[model samples]
Target: MGRNEFTVAFAGNPNVGKSTVFNNLTGLNQHTGNWSGKTVSNAFGCMSYKNITYTLVDLPGTYSLLSGSKEEAVARDYLCFQSPDMVVAVVDATCIERNLNLVLQILEITSRVIVCVNLLDEAQKKSISVDLKELSRRLGVPVVGSSARSGRGMSELKEMIYNMTVNERKTYVDKIIYSPEIEEEAEKIFEKIRQKCKSDRIARFLSLRLLENDEEFNKSLEKSIGISVEAGVHKKEYKDMIAEEIIKTAERIFLSAVSFKNSEYNKRDRKIDRILTSKSTGIPIMLLLFGVIFWITIVGANYPSQWLSSLFESVNQFVRDTLTNIGTDNMLVSVICDGILKTTFWVISVMLPPMAIFFPLFTILEDFGYLPRIAFNLDKYFKRSGTHGKQALTMCMGFGCNACGVTGCRIIDSPKERLIAIITNALVPCNGRFPSLITLISIFFSASLVFPFNSILSALLLLSVIVLSVFATLGLSKLLSSTVLKSERSSFTLELPPYRAPQIGRVIVHSVKDRIIFVLWRAVAVAVPAGLIIWLLANIYIGDSSLLNYFTSSIDGFARIFGLDGVILAAFILGFPANEIVMPIMIMAYTSNSSLMEYDSLTQLHALFTTNGWTVVTAICVLIFFLFHFPCSTTCITIYKETKSIKWTMLAFILPTILGLTACFLISNISRLIFMLAG
Candidate 1:
């Protein structure tokens, strides 16, 4: 380490509050990027304490050092190779037993370590107490109790880190001693590694890995050492013995160092899980939660959306008046106000509120630790459909945005399973699609009912559509897995984290900053150009009719085959940039109004649609098509980026369009047949 600087790596299991500690320590001075040649994200931050700069590296959270997954590989490789000055193993105090396994693994690599037991408040709430002094003695390292949420023990943690790194304080290293047989085998491998390697620390860790017969580690070692260490004929037997011994040692340390006062420390979590994960009630509860969120969003968003629309409308009118007064060309003014300004307003006004409400609500569920249980409940279904269990998690991410969901498929280790996840991700309705789905449900399905119940019905109706989407995702996943992406099911370990009280302020900040604003910005970027193009098509004349009418008329006959008119079809095509603008585009095409015109209320919008020949059957077909249509342009681009193949991206685009057309055609024909019989 340099005199003025030190590098400290933070490592821990997922959900151990590792991120909270990193953020608290580093504040805003951080940047994230992928590890070299890996898709796993690694973050680094720097902070100054007492004139010394402490550079903090946040490793990907993993349960163990053994490289069973990408996260474990990145974290294990960094620790073994990068050789940071100090390793801070952040453990969940509430479940120190399970966390200690990782700490034990880290200790095997380096002696300069600190065990930070986080979430102490949650532990205390459960009547679980840890004797920090005892734990420090057992682990032969510094152990600090912290509640990163409350900023507790942060100063002490930093001071201890400073002392250990700057002062070169000698610390006791309490190492795990394997059984005599395993130790002898490790010693032999250790000697071989030491003869070939310059670093004594790395040699010791490599011996244990070699004993385990870890092929990946062996290949990595060969690359670094420029030599191969061939195992003896009995290496497999020795590896099994060594692995069993490590497990026993971890169990022994956990038994000695941790204790619970309640004996039923996890009773509350178990009780909640019983209800949330019950076979009969689980799916219904999940659906009900979805409906409640949609209801809250639908009811809560109305006033804000209307106010934002009015505000934007006022701005547009002001811009128009200013342009006219300045003698600006009417065509230029129309392009700016009617085309660009109005479309941007419609997207923002429609998208912002629902996103603002939904993201925060979703974040709350996440913070409360319910999302993994959702994945857990859905895992079996995914497995039965010939996909990996983790697809449930990626699918849930798709609800926020398909592009993000596609990126998240890296968690699945199998390439085939990951591809299945990426291809089917768009089947779920993203936040961009929510406004369109919700508005149509309100205007067409729930408009006739009275106040309170009307909103409830709208929410239920939207939930049904969402359920349909989920089924589509599962069905397609099954079909694709069985055919194009045929593969055996892969298993995954899911940790059902203990539920914690969500931090409202943090949840709000994260959801708004990370999700709502991020997605809204993307939508706006696409909406502007789409609006300008729509305006040009409407204004630019061709022959006796405008270009917009000529194209709509040409497509109308084919569109009616799917129970949609040419105008609606044209709107969907133009609205490919962002799904939120699809309805507005349809409105613009149908009313022959200025591209920027805002409907004051749903009643007026309903009247306009009816005047254009919309009916119950038409609304039903439109809803079905909207639920299953092709992904927006952003998602298509994301698919291409993630897959790095035009073939898969095009297939992803075509699959959903085929499903949507087929569904609409069947529904339209069935409805027409029933009408003919009745007449």
Candidate 2:
């Protein structure tokens, strides 16, 4: 029987809404599960078109097919080995040339290529005209325009796939030949490889790759074949020579084919890139963007958060009154009402809104081609730290959550650099810590303002914190590179894609579904148990006070030395499951003191803290401590899972804790000393 089911793979650069297209095509039937032999994820789904089922696989998004990184290797291997019947190379239409390189490279690998010009709506808005027929003719493939967000041209894309799979007509598009000297060497290597390998496609591809001296690809082949390439005919030496030839050849070809002239299509992108990556302008722009996003997150989240908190508080009061009327035990009612449901409600109200706003907007910037420029902007610093410049991208992901950031470190090529990137990912402030920062900002900094400026101030303070965090990361990375994980720096080759407008509909869906809900669920899951524990500690009496009171009072003096209370300290300890629960836990501790189900307003919140000796020092210390706290549970688990050693995992946890504690201690003590001197 002929191949009845054809496999179609979606390949693209990161943040071009590749996943959006995947979702649109497969819908709810898609399943993402583990691969057979690796810990890396695999996604598979089916779509039937014209009475034939096409199994669509979403390969990991990667910038290039150079096999320098694990993700690239994964993508490269599937295209070469799995030999999918049809390859849907999704190119972000707004950034055609850089995107075109991937399209061109894949064309070299397999002729059954479908060039998907995705984000057409965005491209059109940017006034970028991609002549699909012209591009198709030049590249020798069928090019289809698609707006994955709106489900445009999907039917056509699938039809194209079906036709390609059925016809089995391979289009040998093009291979850009190099200078005579380099091409001669490449040809010699190609002839030798052709004589050894059965598959001409594999032979040609491997010859080019081998000549280019891609160590990762060579290692991967060695592992698969049970023979060291180096042991046979000094393959390493031979491959190195070939690699130089290939690089020179490719360099010539790349220079000949692409131009960086300031065309209208790329004018906005080049202008933005110049400023954002400029030595002088880049840092300030990063700060401004950071400040703006936080400001919006803080102000926009406030009304919704307050309403959600009040609504939850009202339910808590109703439950208590109903239980009293119904003659249920007061303790049992308190446990059920304040402990489980109340905590869940607070988590939802406070954490959800900011994430909902932040993720989509963050994703929008990423989709608009701003993110790669960030990496390019910071590449020099990261390279100096003996890591890939794109580690900056991983650090940005850390702002959402450390676990995701650590996972993103896979983008870096060097093992030493990847580890360094992973170890320091948690230093950045995540969405989980945003509420506490907002609370401090609103209470201390923005209490005097009205309307727009109030939110603006709050946003500015948060942005300052982020900027400070970047400096902290840079310093820590520098120290780490010099001391422990020393290795040669792996420089980055960043392709700045053209800027385009983001799709609101798709951004909203991803932010709501993937980020906001996912994170909220994780928080609620952890918060319920934590709430019950906090309730038990606060309610169960021990020697004239509740367990919580006894503990807090015991540590009250020690906490005072650090300008914090035992309850706040305890909350930090308990909140390791997820940072989102820290503020709610602190609130629970505060409200339980009066056993009140409701508070009046922001003034009441301030009054509660002031009554408990909450000085400015206390708030500052809390802010700093939260900013530099240990990795969350998910991050810890990821560290353990990734390193597979309790030692490295513990190191990942401990080093940060020690640093955080020392920094907070030094800052607090220094402030106190300054005050004493002034007095």
C-alpha lDDT score of every prediction, in listed order: 0.81, 0.72
In candidate 1, which residue ranges exceed 4 Å CA deviation? 1-8, 28-40, 43-56, 81-85, 161-198, 215-234, 413-415, 509-516, 537-554, 591-596, 640-647
- TM-scores for all candidates? 0.88, 0.83
In candidate 2, where is summed lDDT lowest over 10 consecutive residues? Answer: 30-39
| lDDT, candidate 2, 98-128, per-residue tens | 5665666676677788988888887776666
Candidate with best lDDT: 1
Error of 2 at 98 (Å): 4.6
Scored by Cα lDDT, where does model 2 land? 0.72
Instruction: Report per-prediction Cα RMSD to one decimal.
Output: 4.0, 5.1
Tens digit of per-residue lDDT, candidate 1, span 1-679: 4599899999988788887788889984221111111123468889899999999988877778885665677788788878889999999988888888788889888989999999999999998888889888888899999998788988899988998999886678765676676678777777766877646767777777877777777776777675475842235676666556567766776777777888998999999999999999998899889899989999998899899888988999999999999999999998898888887888888888888888888778777888788878898888877787677777777887787788777777777888888888888888878888888889998989998898999999988888888788889989999999998666677788899988889777766676556656755687788888888888788767888888898999999999999998888888787787788788878856334335757888888888888988888888887777788888999889888999999988989889989998998889999999998
